[model samples]
Target: MSRAITSETKHSIISDFKEITKIRLSVSVVFSSIAGYLLGVESVDYNTLILLALGGYFMVGASNAFNQVIEKDLDALMNRTKYRPVPAGRMSVNTALIIATIFTILGIVILYTINPQTAMFGAISIFLYTCAYTPLKTKTPLAVFVGAIPGAIPFMLGWVAATDDFGIEPGTLFAIQFFWQFPHFWAIGWFLFEDYKKGGFFMLPTGKQDKGTAVQTIMYTVWTVLVSIIPVFGVTGRLYLTPISGVIVFILGLGMLYYAIQLYKKMTVLAAKQLMLASVSYITLLQIVYVLDKFIR
Candidate 1:
């Protein structure tokens, strides 16, 4: 009986850890970082790739854990987040703080082993996301802009990790992901406006999902599409997107824009959800197209 109880306790602890880190979100961030590394490196290095993935996981996980800690009170008021380990009493604030700190330190140390620049950027991402962006969520709608800086860094962080320096390649990667985030996040904000309102987070640009926010979403979507196709012009040096791949990417971008426009026209919860899904698909497909274009060309 004692052994059975011990096993259950261990399982409960593991579940709490996973909840705090938000494993799915961490994995998504790590995926973007790996895609960036693959796009940035001239030749793939498995060792460096592993280090980048591990470092990204730790950094993003720590950020998420700390975010939960900081927002615990507000989280309890929202149905979507009320059951979170930190807010639901499954984990203690002190425990979350200790875990976040340890993970962040370990992540930075591993990244430093890869390259100092990568480590520095990783630390900056965590600091910006946790210290700056999290607190700003309730205060201003511009918080999305601040959050995007760290959110977009992972895509470029991998390149810097592999190359240990900042250059045109990483810059291009950053620009692509940076622009991609506005539409993506705004769509999410549109759909989750109610939940966000409950927590006092002003995520929409206009503080309401009106014509202004819709227009801004479309504008950013246009910019994201334009930037995605720029590599085909052969102006980005080693990053070249062939004419065929460029056309395909353009079509994908148009598809995303169509949904964005639809959301604008309707401005319903359903339309916003469609736009959200489309944005997610657009980003994942864009990354795949980039990788395939690199290999095929």
Candidate 2:
């Protein structure tokens, strides 16, 4: 009976850790980091790749955990976030803090083993996301802009991890993901505007799911599509996209824009949800196209 109880306790502890780190969010961030690393590295090193991924995961996880701890009160007020571990009382704030601190330190150390630039960027991402963006959520709509900086850093962080320097290639990768976030986030904001309002969060640029915000969402979608195709013209230094790939990317972009326009016209929750889905598809497909184009060309 004691052994059985011990096993259950261990399982409970593991579950709590997953909840505290937000495994789903960490996985998504790690995926983007891998995509960026694949695009950046001329010759991939397996060891460096593993380290980059591990570091990226912990860094993003730490940020998410800290954000939850900081926003526990605000989270409890929101329907969407109230069930999270910290807000739901499944985990204590002190435990979350310790987990976040340990993960952050480990992440930075792993990144530093690969390169200082990687560690530096990782630290900056955590600092900005936790220290700056988390609190700003309730203050102003411009918080989205601040939030995007850290959100976009993973893509560039991967590049620096592999190359240990900043250049046009990393810059291009950063631009692509950077512009993509506006539409993606705004679409989510539109769908959950009511829920976000409950937490006093102004995610949309206009602070409402109005035509103005939708227009801006579409504009950023357009910019994301444009920037995504820039590498195809052979001007992004080591990052080159072929003519055929360029057309394919353009079509994908147009598809995303069409949905954005649809959401803008309807401004319904359903439309916003569709736009959110399309935004996710756009980014994932765009990354695949980029990787395929590099190999095929």
Candidate 3:
């Protein structure tokens, strides 16, 4: 017997598609790449910016889809992830694989139109994320480090797309985002420790929420703040910031640092959650300040 799909069924399918692609997270990643592009370009090209947004979105979406597929079983074990499309039976592994593959191809092709380096880096991010970082989650806490590589690339990937060159400017951008990930992710791990344990995933620096992890979080937060302000020293080449902008950035870093210190002193899940939210806001604001400073000055 043949059955026609209802409007509710159609909406549910679309919702599943969005969930499988992790649309919101992917869009946030695209924003980072666009910010990087804006920082590097002398003038904006609306066409290229559009292409970068689409390509960046596709690459990140592909990575998330593949990650969901790979971790579907483990995801089912964790309360936070158990309702994701694949684990919840709203989408099948084969369907997710097809979507990921399509996204990967489209992302690479679109980026290649910008430059070979852009395409190459896009491919590398997807490969390292799906092949290396996803698998390492269960085995070691160092997976966060591996994941940071791909996570940080989007910001600098825009620089390469803008100039088709890799140098100190892009390198500095990468360093800022790279170092930021430790404190940010560690805070997330701290608050989600119990949920992650159910999935056998080790995400904390010391493999547990204790003083050691708090200390490491504080250490990395310091490092992230230091790297973020390096552009003001006039050593980062084209990435230099004005005195006023530099002060603003330093102050922003201090705001995040305050929360990190709080996490260290309290060692409570509440403190960790606060730090996590602070870190997220900090990065988005940092990118905005950098872009606005460039144009306003």
Candidate 4:
């Protein structure tokens, strides 16, 4: 009985840890970092790649943990986030703080092993997300804009990690992601407007899901699509997508925009959700196209 109870306790603790870390979201952030790393590398070093992945994941996890800790009360007010580890009473605040501190230290150390620039970017991302973006969420709609900075950092951080330089190539990558986040986050804001309101989070442009917010989403979607093709113009320096791949990327962006337009016309949760899914697909496919073009074309 004692051994069985101990095993159950261990399993529960692991589950709570995963809840705090948000494994899937952390993994997606790591995936973007790896994609950028691949784009910037002439010769792939698998070891550094592994360290970058680990470092990126850990930093994201730590940021998320801090967010949960700070918003525990607010999270409990929203149905979607009410069941999270800290809000659900499954994890202690002190335990979560300890985990976050360890993650921050380990994450920065690991990224430093790759390059100081990468480590610096990772640290900056965490600080901005937790210290600035998280607090600003309930205060103003502009929080999304501030949050986009850190959200977009992983792509350029990877290039910096690989090349140890901050140049036009990585800046272009940063710009592409920076604009893409407006539509991406606004779509989530559109769908979750009610839930966000419950927590006093003003995520939409107009602070509500309405035509104004939808219009902004359309504009940002257009901007994101336009930026996606800039790599083929030869101005991005070391980064140049082939015309063929650029065409494919344009079509994918159009697919996302189609859903965005639909959301604008309908102004329904389903429409917003469709746009959300399309945005996810668009970004993932665009990254894949760029990487494939880099090697093959």
Report the number of the highest-lDDT candidate.
3
Which residue runs does candidate 4 get wrong by more than 4 Å? 1-7
What C-alpha root-mean-square deviation, in Å, does candidate 3 show against the real structure? 1.9
lDDT of 3 by residue, 2-65 (tens): 2345777888899988888889888889989999999999889999999999999999989999
Per residue, candidate 2 scores C-alpha lDDT tens digits across 1-297 of 999999998998887788778887788788888888888888889999899889998998899899999999999999988988889998899989999999999999999999998899899999999999999989998888888888888887877877888999989888988899899999999999999999999999999989999999999999999999898777888888898989999999999999999988998999999998998888888888887877767
- Lowest-sum lDDT 10-residue window in model 3: 1-10
State the local distance difference test value for candidate 1.
0.91
* Residue 291 accuracy (lDDT) in model 2: 79
Task: Please write out the lDDT profile of model 4 over residues 56-82, one tens digit for every residue.
Answer: 999999999999999999999999999
**TM-score for each prediction?**
0.96, 0.95, 0.97, 0.98
Q: Measured by C-alpha RMSD in angstroms, how accurate is candidate 4?
A: 1.1
After superposition, candidate 3 runs with Cα above 4 Å error? 1-5
Per-candidate local distance difference test: 0.91, 0.89, 0.94, 0.93
Q: How many residue pairs clash in each candidate?
A: 0, 0, 0, 0
Model 1 alpha-carbon drift over 4 Å, by segment: 1-8
Q: How close to the true structure is residue 104 of candidate 3, measured as C-alpha lDDT?
A: 100
